[model samples]
Target: MRRFRARRRQEPTNQMRYSSATDVPQVVPPPIEAAAGRVTESERRTSSQRFRGDIQGLRAVAVLAVLGFHTGMPLLSGGFVGVDVFFVISGFLITGLIDREIGRTGRLRLSRFWARRVRRLLPATAVVLVTVGAMTLLVLPMTRWSSVAWDIATSALYVVNWRLADQSVSYLASDDAPSPVQHYWSLAVEEQFYIVWPLMILLVLWLQRRYRLPLTRAMLTGIAAIGVPSFIWSIVLTKTSPGPAYFVSTTRLWELAIGGALAILAHRIPRLPAVWAHLLGVAGLTAIVLAVVTFDAATPFPGIAALVPTLGAAAVIAAGTVGRRTISDLVLDTPIMRDIGTLSYSLYLWHWPLLIGAAAMWGEDNELPVTIAVTVVGFSVVPAWLTHRLVEAPIHRAKVFVRLPGWAAVLGVVCTAIGVATAVIVSLAVPKQPSYAVGGEAPGAAVLDAIPAQDPDGRPADSVDLLVPDVLAAREDLATLGGEPCISELEGTELEACSYGPEDADVTMALVGDSKAHQWLPAFQRIADERGWRILTYLKSACPLARVDIKYEDRANQDCAEYNETRYDRLHELESIDYVVTSQVASQAYLGPNESQREQTDAMVEDLRRTWTGLEDAGRQVIVLVDNPNPEHEVIECVAEHGDELSACAFPRAIGAERGGAPAQLAALEGLDGVSSVDVNDYICPGDMCPAVIGNVLIYRRGSHLTATYVDSLTPRLDEALIAAMR
Candidate 1:
């Protein structure tokens, strides 16, 4: 299933008591309150220094948004923004703790602080990791074991955010099953922030000591120094690449910095008038509520759009500086709200796994129906409560862990090792086998190509228990161009001039378009090697040769069309001696937003025709290879699940054709002379039915991209098509 397309997951707070987790930690005990007229030393402290129950209320609000979003509650469509809320809260809490500690004491005790964090955060995290590890082994199929195992291990190591961020940018893994621990990315970000912020605080403190600078000014300056560039990058990167930008710490640091800045400013300014504070609080709540209801997965996140929620969270915290007399505290600090806030971290950790695991059990990765989703989240509370009571609270309050920071450090190491060990053990449990090579045993596409299946869907009756490429290994079966990846990255149109042919060959041909064009590389390379023709490959992921907008990952990918602009222009300059062959995987789903799919298809076809016409005008004979059939779901997983009944993976030809680029290819080629097109549907989907496996070969790999081994098997047919086009 597409990972988190319908919802977003966040785990930011380290569950502890309100005083320990989010309150402005007074360096000393017994916080002083001002009398009716006179006051305590203004420089010594600030207002709202007591345990802020409202911050806990903010946690409750954020986690509720998370619950609503994950459970497919329509009102919380933009619930993913909850992560920003948590980040802001965490920033305020942690930065205040550090700043206050340093202000009172000459030195900041890093070891004790880290120990406190570890004791508070690690036990529950480790428990969840072990639970997920156990679930993967016992509940999930062997096909998902490896990926999820690594995910668990990384979560244990607090690096899954990086793992997820990298995968988010990757085309091959984009549509794969999400890790149950995917929500841990926020925790990872916080952990990394935890590591960095102290150093930053120390630097700020050092600058104050060195230059005799004012502490508040230095702190604010330090926050601005880190936060300004980060916010700028967040905005820029979100526009071009939203996936990584969402998970990467650099893109999200500004939210935390905003909170830090608020903390410092709160101390410097006098407490706000009650009416203004209440107004600010109400406006802040309104901003957060507006974002939760109105924003969606399509909204560019943690960028300029993110400012609404992050600043709103900051606004709420800032308003709280007036000390709970305000309207926000009235609603936010009710017993139930504060109680939920106390349990929020555990709730965040437990909810996603239960939801994902239950869905995985039911053979789905998409958002569950609202009723069921809500039921699952509701069910999650039992474990969340149990964990909070049993694991989180006891360890957090333990003085043994607190006084002896080394013991807490050791406990963290042990927990981390347990997570890693679980991953290794689970990985070992999965059966390992070398992939089947195309030979007498695995004929791949050869058997069906030799004799078309008499059966309605050309599924040759094979009595093999195991498929060639292992089910788990199928998605990574990407075709290579020359010696490099044929498709350029999603963000850039930088094409490599990788030539595939004998160097002495006089005839030069180029294979161009999106990854659909890349899938035919093996066949074309075989043809080039045999027929003595030089072929150049220019392929970009989701970028077609057409000049139309594309909607990928549910957002309008302006980059794809913009990349095409630069690419098609450069294609005009590649006055290479001869032919330019191309294909596309573009479907109605991939086309830019329009009132109707027909209009989108027509506009796409027009642009595709224009693109092809230009290539033809450049003295290059163009051969458009008709795109292949696409199944609604990935086939290998189905193949794995129903090894005894492979027919479960077959789909109707009509459905497959509509999902592929065949209709668009046919339309673009119509009424055009000198340009030839070839349809391999007879081989790919025989007798009006498309089967997942044809002639012992898995037809599709990632998304609709054809497997190299299968494409290799169709070499002779593609050679004939190329020859016919030349004729």
Candidate 2:
């Protein structure tokens, strides 16, 4: 025991200094018997070294899977598993390198390792980022520029994964176009792994030496105990909040550990007959292929489901190149696979930007032909090879690579400056958005005028709930406007609800509907104040005021239907309401049983017509404001996402019975006696495409939803329509 302890102590040389791989000393094994005496069965088994082409082949597989998936190739639907494969490969390679280094020298060179990795990664990254930055400025709309710039900066720093997670771009939300850098999330994961993994290995190695512990035994024990719990956490977290699972590095650490475990056990696989080796390799390859074929977005990620590909990779790696040859070996070692493997990093970096840039320049609807894809392929190869040859290999080979303090600082500063410059350029090029445009008027003053104003003594509305308080900065400018917040949080649900004015204001007018009518509120408020109308608002986000019950995404929204019904009942009980005003888009989806699209729409129209007719029969005047034409951009996204395409953001003025037709829906009200339809199409859409911004206010706050400013601006028009309808 004492002799064994002394030998273990002698293994880690204090003289071994922290340095680059180039400076790493050669390792020689002790005599087999003596080494065995010093090491345990588990330790020897755990620390074996075996070369596996399957892993490299696996790399080829992963990259191909990802590339095919991104290319929208029909055969590669499950190509997303490529990232999982990469995770396993990363773990294997990193662990192999660390374990081998520790076995040879007893200490790990943390800085030099990181520097080589940075050089390997950063050069091509810088090139792609600069290229994408230039292209974003050249073709992207001004409104999108800011976000693109911010994303570029984050990607450059390897922190883009966190930012994207925070943005909550649902993994399933299949927007036609995605950002070019969206693929960087995986790169970020890899980079983060590189940052901490070497240190972890070093700590483990030091602990092994200090305690006279066998290295392999320590690693295996640590991995099993730590890795299993991590895997469980990953599953739980992924199921609970996929957003966090996607973004958080901690959840993914175990995937790499799987590869690390394989590295620790590489040499122990019983030497199999050539036929068995070939069979195992073939089986492993088939498993991977099947996984790639069947997996999809709905599949739970990085969980136990990930093990199929991971274990398959491990099996292939275990079936080494020597002694047994499989058809997979021939395929993987083929020149094409090898070349793609060589260029994988570069290909990954370039493909997304090329695709996205192409999408931005042309629309996403167009396909990138073989020529364009090949052009992207060409661009990827040249730069990647050059970066590997020039920056990565040479820097890694240099002795200075190990001893550089100022270099890291200098590199960081340069990266920061580039990021800042890119940001400023993007910001300067993007147009500034003017305030107030929510539904389709000028942002500031023009929107205000566009709002409908009520005549004095019109007590049709009351004060608003949660009106912008004078104390809050956002509310300061709007304080004089004097309407309730277009959105009020309901009690238990804490969801935003829209109500007209104070419930008891002598005269009552209900501002009821989806976000579109919400946009028309400023105009309604003006009319209410002048007419002394008590405003009663009943509204929900994305839930239109149509009485037709509806389903959302196949789920019944009984709460929404109930909410509307209750609000209507409250309005019926109101004592002072002399007039009823309901405004909403006609094409809104409703939720309920027996609520086919047509039925829901017809039911909504009938409900509104019935309410108006009932009010008229009760001797109360009834006026209906025709819903505004919907813009392609949501009322808010027009402000937030598409502010650059100001014209594209606006509501179309053309009146028609086509889809999203408010005029047609309102026209149905014509036959209802004592109910009048007030058309605001002229005020909203003035041309072919509905403009998101008229004078300058963002017409919609998001997509087709109107901003409070634009909603506030509709006072005059709403008032005019009411007066005309009442007359």
Candidate 3:
């Protein structure tokens, strides 16, 4: 007689077990095994080992959410949570496989297990990396290319998480736009987890065997011990140092443990009622969708906030019944959902780069077409399906490779090493050309070809060659470019507080503004010392000297606005400050369709007028320094492009001077009774062509900003301009 019965197992969405006698306690004790020993064929048939369609559908939802978000679609703003979904899914699947293998076999074959993993992960990853490298070279600018190359090398090594952490402190890293491979940070995290988790499971299993503890009890104990602390550390670290905490591997272990815990209980839960199973699955899927919609970058990550999706994934995975239900059967167990689930892994890998590449090509300012993002998805899916069939399936079916674990290990290491080396070489060897080069090959081809070739001269070039010097000389020319030493020998031990000035100083000159103002310091200090004038500084990073309508990069620059407003107020109250010097970043920080030159000029003039009016009212003098000419590229690059032949490379004299674009607004300022604009363009430029270097100092520090050293060298020229403006 054949007996038919349904058996169910309850597995957590995230967890793993080790293959050893100690890893898991025997489900049945030896003494009781004899009573139930005559296990009939009918009993084996009752065991539950069936695929859950709802869980697959959930995978589809998670992947699609992430894809939508990356595509820059407004609908999936919180789609980044797809990673959380993936983590849970990975945990559940890996743990279940480990547990099942360990329970059935006496020992875990490390080689066989790794081979299986390699087959699953390697081929698709290779396809993506190679494609990304090609696209990066094709689209990114020269300024952006080197960094992109470095990031690609790091990504290939699966260490991009560490790289991102190092760059976290830089303002550039947090800029609104990010690179294509930035999404690889998650892959790095997962790969790092894989390194320690398997060994940890083995150790736990061994201890259980030696101690004669129940497998369930040992697993639970280990999970609690590891998971609780990891969770706490994640919370503490995320709060204390968010970027590092988010990227580090130590903080992510618990998410995997959540799945491992699921593996521990996979054999226990009985079949749920069809109605209840469907409700649970549907509820879990809905929760995941809701979580995606709510989470964003500003939200603290990998903490308790992550639990929402983690638990939701577990709910869907554990809900085994796939029978037609009121909700789950209708929505979660559909054919369309299953197709997405099957393609989810490859889709996740391919979509981010597509979106990033699209955004880069389209320019962040332009609204990317919905069809473009959709097209990327469509293109990605075809390769993903082919890879799954041609690469993944073949590797899985070939048992001969799995039998030779050592060979598999060697192959895996060799392939990975070769790929990484190729990426490194490609990065170092590839030269960046202008975007236009790809459009056509002409003399520009020579320009493109010359891109990677280093200049024969050893010295670094200035960022901007905006000097119109009659004669150009090598950087060695300006020994006395920086001003003479001016010191104030104070009694205090504090080094920074000790003031500096001329031996017999009478006039007081104050410099204040953002980094732009600071750039002028070396020049101002030099002139002040030579003229027996005391120089006081009230400068800050990126904080321009302005009062009303203060904002930068489209956001309210509260700190800068407050700092400048307060400093101006304090300066006006001072009895001293015979001459005040300041500069600003005008077009660099603000310029667009919405922000016209007219509007910016008017606001800037008004702010200057207010400051001048107040200072003059208090019997003081104020000098308004015009905006420095920003360069399109770094000056050194210009010098290098000119083969370090300074005379051959010329800077435009018209770059920084007042122009028709803003002169009417400046005339409004000139209308003020006591205010005047000091133009430094003449002294700095001197002619139609400007030299990047004068007196041996590098002209531009970056693309347009003046370097501190070069600014120091400009003291003599700047002093002459200031004297005229002050008089």
Model 3: per-residue Cα lDDT over 1-727, one tens digit each: 1111000000011111111111112221111111223333333223323445655666777777777665556646566677777776666566655655565454456667776666566556666777777777676433344566677677767787777665553332322235566767767777776666667667777897798766667767877687778889989876655556666666777877786676566444334566666667667777787877776554566687878777777677656433234365466568998777767766666766666667556632223566676677678887778866676556655676767666666656765765576577656654443211122211211221233323323222333233221112222112121342221111111112113575346888776554455556666656766777887776554455566544442334444555656677767776767777666554222333267766766666666667668777877777767656654333544454453476554545465344212242254467775766666654344445555664444465443455555555456557767878776
- Indicate the residue-level lDDT of 34 in model 1: 18
Off by over 4 Å in 1: 1-50, 363-367, 434-440, 453-458, 502-506, 589-594
Ranking of models by lDDT:
1, 3, 2
Question: Which stretch of 10 consecutive residues in model 2 shows the poorest summed lDDT?
Answer: 1-10
Q: Best candidate, lDDT-wise?
A: 1
Mark the regions of model 3 whose C-alpha exceeds 4 Å error after superposition. 1-48, 172-177, 268-279, 321-326, 364-367, 430-727
lDDT of candidate 2 over 610-657, digit per residue (tens): 656665776566666666555443333333343344443334345322
* Shift in Å, residue 204, candidate 1: 2.1
Q: On a 0 to 100 scale, what is the lDDT of residue 444 in model 1?
A: 69
lDDT of 1: 0.75
Better of 2 and 3 by lDDT: 3
| Candidate 1 local Cα displacement, residue 519, angstroms | 1.0
lDDT of 1 at 677: 85
The top-ranked prediction according to TM-score is 1
Error of 1 at 506 (Å): 4.8
